[model samples]
Target: MDPTLFSSIDFYQLAKREKNAQKRIRLLALAHVKEGKPRDEIAESLKVSRSSVNNWVRRFRCDGLEGIGNKQRSGRPVYLQPQQEELLRNFIESHKLSSDLPPLKGKDIHAFLKHYFDIDYDISHVYRLLKKLKITL
Candidate 1:
C-alpha cells in the first residue's frame, strides 16, 4: 500500500458531513486510502476509475475536501427576474379569483409575458414556470 495521502480521521469527518452521494463516496475512498488500502482496491470497491481515484487524491492534496465536491455550473439564466415572477404570480392569482376570466392556459401566460415584459418564452417553458410558481392547471 502507498503511504496515506491524508489523515483517515479528517477524511471520515468529511465523508460523514458530505451531502452529495458521489462526493461522499469519493471522501470514503480517500479515507480507505488513508487506512493503507491499495488504489486498485479502493477504485474497484467504489466502482470508479483508478484515474478518478488518483484525481480525487490529487484534488484533496491540493485543495482539501472542497475540491472533491461538485463544481458550480452555469445553467441558462432566468428570463424573468424575481420581481417579474412575483408580478406574474399576482396577475395569475387575481385572474383566477375573477369568475368572468376564462381558465388561463400556458399560451395565455406566454402572451402576457410577451406583451407586458417583452419576454418571449415557449409555451412549455411558460407552463414549467407556472408550475414552479404553484399555479394550478
Candidate 2:
C-alpha cells in the first residue's frame, strides 16, 4: 500500500466521531490499511468484502476524507416548504390557544392540509410532521 494513500492524522479520530456504523467500519478498515495490515486481513477482521474495502480506498484516494462518509440520498421531498410549515405550525398553536376551536387532531390536520395545500399526506406522516414542527397536539 502506498504511504501517501493515508492521511497523516489518525483515522481513528474520524471513526470515533462517526455517527454512521458502516462509515465507521470503513474508517477503521482504512486505519488498519494505513498501519500496514494486508487488505485481506483488514477485510476479514472487519467482516466486510475485500471489494468494499478496495472501493473505499479508491473513493478516499479520488475525493479524500469526505468521500468516506455517506452520500446524499434522493428520497421523498418535503410536502410543505419551510415558510408554509411555519405558517401551519403557527395556525395550530393559535388554534390551541383559542377556546372556540376544537382540539386539533391528526385527522383535522390531514383534512386542513388537503383543503388548503391540496396535499394529501398519510395520517402517520401528518403526525410525524406535527412532531417535527413541535406542535403538541
Candidate 3:
C-alpha cells in the first residue's frame, strides 16, 4: 500500500495533540508508515507487533484518519449521550476554581454526572470516562 495517503507532518501533529496513549501509538505508527519505513522496522521501533502496524496501515488506507478511531460494537448502550458529553465538557470548563469553590475532584464529577445526567458509573469508571473524553483529572 502507498503510505503517502497521510503525510508525515500531518500524522506528527495529530499524534502530538492526541491525549490517548493507544491512539497516539497508532498515529505514530502511521506516521512512520507514511515516511515509507518498513512495517516490521516501524513495529520494532514502536514496540508493537508487526501485524498491528499492518492493520493500522490498512485502516488508514481505507478510511484515512477516521479509520483509526474507536469503532462501534455490540454492547450496552452508553450511559452518557454525546449531547450530554458536550454539556459536561462545557460545565467543567465553566466551573473554574475560585476562592469560594475548590477544584473539582473525581467524586465531585461523579456526583455531577449522577445528579445531572441521572447516570451512575463506578468511581473507577469515572476516571476511564474522563480519559475517554480527553478531560484531565
Model-by-model lDDT, in order? Answer: 0.86, 0.88, 0.85
In the predicted model 3, the residue pairs found to clash are none
Taking all chains together, each candidate's TM-score versus the true structure is 0.64, 0.69, 0.50
lDDT of 1 by residue, 1-137 (tens): 22343653477887788788999999899888887899999999999999999999888788776778888899999889999998998998899899998989888888999999999998889988888888785
Worst 10 residues of 2 by lDDT: 1-10
lDDT of 2 by residue, 16-134 (tens): 99888999998998899888899999999999999999999888877788878889998988889988898788889889999998899999989989998999999999999988987
What alpha-carbon RMSD in Å does predicted model 2 have with respect to the real structure?
A: 3.6
Better of 1 and 2 by lDDT: 2
Cα-lDDT of candidate 2? 0.88
What does the lDDT read for residue 104 in candidate 1? 90
Best by lDDT: 2
Q: Residue 63 in model 2: shift from native, Å?
A: 3.1
Error of 3 at 92 (Å): 34
Deviating ranges (above 4 Å) for candidate 1:
1-5, 10-20, 31-51
Instruction: Give the clashing pairs for model 1.
Output: none
Model 3 compared with the native: what TM-score?
0.50
Candidate 3: lDDT of 35? 76
Writing each residue's lDDT as its tens digit, candidate 3 over 1-137 gives 34555653488888899998888999999888777899999999999999999998788888878888878789977898899999888877777634467788889899999999998889998898899999874
